[model samples]
Target: MMLFEKKSPYKQLLNLFLLSSFVLRIVLLFHPITTTSFSWAEIIKIFLTGFLTDFFVFITASSLIWLYLLFLSESKYTKPWGYIIFGGFLSLLIYVACFNTILNEYGGVLPEIGIGFVALKTTFFGLMLFLPKYRKHIRIALFSIAIFIITLIIIQNSISEFFFWNEFGVRYNFIAVDYLVYTNEVIKNIMESYPIIPLFIGVGIITAFFTYKIVKKSMPFLEKLPSFQEKIKSTVGYIALFALATFLVPVLAKQETSTNVFTNELQANGLYRFFLAFRNSELDYNKFYKTLPDNEAFTLLNQQLEIESNATSTQIIKGRTTEIKKNVVLITIESLSADFMKMYGNELNVTPFLDSLATKSTVFSNLYAVGNRTIRGLEAVTLCLPPSPGESIVKRKDNKNKFSTGSVFKEKGYSVKYLYGGDAYFDNMEDFFGGNGYDIVDKKTFKPEEITFDNVWGVCDEDMAKKAIQTMNAEAKTGKPFFNHWMTVSNHRPFTYPAGKIDIPNDAKSREGGVKYTDYALKQFFKMAQKQAWYNHTVFVIIADHCASSAGKTELPMDKYRIPAMIFEPGKEASINPILMSQIDIMPTLLGRLGFNYKSKFYGQDVYHPSYKPRAFIATYQDLGFIRNNILTILSPKQKVKQFDLSLQPSKLPVAFQLYYDEKPKNTIDPTLVNQTIGFYQTTATLLKNKRYQKK
Candidate 1:
């Protein structure tokens, strides 16, 4: 065996291909893993995205590398670096088209400049590689031009979106430019930011260099080139490896997707249609509780959306109700539920202060929390739509769309103020609230002495409530009715209450103890509220943002969505309304009692309205249930519809049940009612697809 066995050209090609791929992978491996740690699933996704992106990259790079190396090689007019270069270029173009095709399917339009930058990066890799002379300069210049055009397109298209986000803090799903914004800021916000992006880019550059050297050292001269059959044999391993990568990428992405508590494909797309249904139709975000579909599901769902739109239009035209009204205070209690509170018939007297308040106020016994998260609760109580499933409105494309509440109230001159004990930026709620025209006060706004936080989430509930009271008192001095929203935070995870205030049993979990402390905070808040001048004139609307569960029993079924909602008129008497309702219904109900004639874009009906029947819309992370007049229908992909009879003292469920069985909406299988219910859910899905809310 000589130094080069038969010096086959085919061997040279195989070596070059492998070298290119290895270089790309090594570079990627050295690149700091994105600061956003890759779960095994994300790692697989990286392989997939990288596989496609690098295919073209390798082609262009290898060709450029071979050309430069041939010139440098001095001996390789024999190397036939041209053949490897040609193969790489062809493969890369195919890869770009495939990636862009997927993007185009979702209506993406990449700027010409962005395309140019991609070409440049490919050229830069090739130039660093050893290559031949005749084709080297032309290829380099062409690659550079392509890179320049793509970068220009990217920069041009991104500038507007960049300003939109930086100046206004607007974020959207799939905007691509937002990634650039975050990347740029990764170095700026030292504490509240991510780190992996730059590391990967740096490592990638280094790996490319080593790969080219490997290719240059290993190539054979043209006189020793192999036959076509040998070339095919040599390429089989590379082909099989590439094919395997192609099939694995999406599978890994989907596997990663399953880890999320909620599942909604619409989140993968934008929630544009749902927002449109919100702005243009009558569906409320909080009041609606179910997964919103993006495309086909949305079209089918929106068939009867016009009916709701007409209702909304009717309310808008009729305008604000002229009535002797009280000021409004909307309190979003953190992680509260009827099951956890003593007043809602729970066994433990966990909420004694709230219990006492319930007796004096209009207590809604069957109010349900829609989504499982706090942001979902925010959207529900404020925007009145079903939860956006896996995606949050604060981070989605619909964030810029003006929801009707703040706009409607502001139009009426009701000064709006929002107070939360945490970072409004956490759920992107601060930007969202400000977009809707509410003045926000969060942890960043608090004075040093006034700030006492249990953790990074926000300030304590006591301080937040106190500040809200002070703000309300100041507003009262102006004699203008106001809209105040207070979102509490102490009852959240890693719960910590004020020191030495109350002694929870040692056996109880820290969360349960936190709940006990929040109850005390509520008592203190009300004590302060009573002293405020606006107390008598304000109609207090209180509802939980979510529920609290200890380690043992806090898990959810459909019933976990059941939480407490109460309306209190200070000088008024207590009353019980046993009708089942949900968070989506809160806004409409409050507006109704205030004698506001406007109809709401809510799936929930007013519990206080005599003509309104009780229908509970319940949601778990992956399941949805409809409970009306004691009959519950749980819907899931695994099992479609499950019926339960809550009319039985303790709700009874069938062990093995079928969804579309003999069970009907009214228990009589009334086709008309079934059509109405089906129509409603379908219409909701359509609204999400259209993003109807953005229109308004």
Candidate 2:
């Protein structure tokens, strides 16, 4: 008759699991990964609605364990079921523990731990086998330990997810797995630079204690087994409940996809996101996702690319021919959004040097970056291709030896080098560039004495510029037209620069400060270069990797993707081009400027070419944006198309209702624009998925 008497242990365990899962979901709801801020009322609504999906997933995931327990309740092996459950739970705990620890240290999951993890699981089971007499006591101890471990892991994963989101602006995806290749370097950097180990351990212990106490209290039903008839009834009820929870609940409570990426991501659970990432890590545009007929898609793409009908998918486009082979220096500045520059109407004066240089250079007034991430920008400029779904080609398997920009330079007998202020291995930059025939010059190549300043990213921008000059000088000795790509990292978060270089002090770290420091470093680099012999022969091409702020109400905010691009050749007349261009166009455009004729598989056309059209391709991870003839079209999953009139002046605000698609604007939709949008995105997806970007 007591509250704790004659209760079922299985029911108690299920209650504990549900309670813990709900708590974890509630905590994550409060701490959203997106930059978009929500009001208290909005947050509550999202939490309440999102709970439906979360509960469905939790029940589905735990159903197997519940069914297993039910089966054991009807068998003579019921007592030993506790030991089996303990062993299975312990194995899962060990795997998650190792996976999370490795991810924290190395920024990825390590597959090499599988063998060792299996051995550890076997040892735990072996120990349980020898303790048959103490089975009851061991079960209680193991159950408590499992609950504590799971709680600690949840807290740890939540913290890690926050940091990951802060840097990349999305939940962890398959691209994160690429970091495992540099485990030693990542671990070393974490140990030497970050001092948060003690804090994590302290918080983990406190959380585990509280979680254990709650779990122990939840196990109030623990007395005895039911009679055969009672068990049969309970089993049938559970099976029916399981079927409803697993099948019907998911269908009824599925989360809806929204036009706002932030909202869609907010609705997602971390475990769900991780599972989705793993499931679609290698997507087939034709089979897994939406697509068009191959021939039709290719025909559309060929027309857009202005290729011959008989030409093969990978057929090279022979661009303008020239006798001169100029030394090219491509500078990709990090987080240098166009709006940050004075030329773009910003009054900050943060990039005075770049602003002044823009006036003297062949500046492109309307250039859009292909995607938000640095890797995406890199892929666009180097491969001159459209953004593919999932991860960038740079991080994908067998991504090397393609017809990249470096391959063009290498074929032309130029010394091609990919220069980075940070570890090129961080995002598979080293592998991609090296595999494409570019010699890698990164932080590892720098001497200790050569580094005047440094941060977690790598050597300061000034030091990197100095090293670049030294490398180019050596390359010049060989009398080869060298192509050097200097990817700057000073304009990144936790921005630090050498003292006394800029008006903004190192202690006053901010985005404005980072921009100013980056400008100062460039000014210094040009000053130092002016004295060098290669200054006059070399053509300096300055472009941004991507914009700093990619978040907006619109799916692909054109303003955010608009970046400054200028080709600076000494003693040449400066002219501004107002044509809309994409980042992928830069390579072919550069080649045309140098008058170099080469067989290229690039989808980007030279802006100066007679056949060139003023258009841009922009995208989020999942949504594709195409702009042409003053119209903007967005192609999203499920074959949804949204179009808008983007003829409004860049300096002016869009009419309130004209920003996105809504019920009121549905009548004004243009079928032509919609078709054009679908054509471009579908074709691009087909090309990328089929690896048609490269010629056979």
* Top candidate when judged by lDDT against the true structure: 2
Model 1 Cα shift for residue 634 (angstroms):
4.9
Expressed as tens digits, the lDDT of each residue in 8-36 for candidate 2 is 43444444444554565455445443535
Against the true structure, candidate 2 reaches a TM-score of 0.79
The TM-scores of all predictions, comma-separated, are: 0.56, 0.79
- Give me the displacement of residue 421 in model 2, in angstroms: 2.8
Model 1 gets an lDDT of 0.53
What is the per-residue lDDT of model 1 for residues 1-696, given as tens digits with 9 covering 90 to 100? 111133422233334444444443334333332111235654555455444533433333233333332333322223366446644754665566556644455564553444554565456445534454434555445433433333333232233323222221221222222334345332333222223367445434443443343334334432234444544553464455446645543343243233222111111111221222234222333244334333433333334222243313112222234554578889988888656666544656678888888889987776778766677788778776655434556556567654556655665568888888877776678888887788998877788888654454567788887788778888888877899888887775456556766677422336566677788888888899888777888898889987653111111244456678889898889987766677878876777676664434454445555545556555543345555644555544322344444433332322211011122233443333233344445454445555655424
Which segments of model 1 are wrong by more than 4 Å? Answer: 1-322, 344-348, 401-403, 505-509, 549-556, 620-624, 634-674, 688-691, 694-696
Residue 475 miss distance in model 1 (angstroms): 1.2
Which residue segments of model 2 deviate by more than 4 Å? Answer: 1-45, 61-141, 160-206, 219-257, 288-292, 311-322, 452-455, 496-500, 503-509, 647-669, 685-692
Error of 1 at 295 (Å): 17
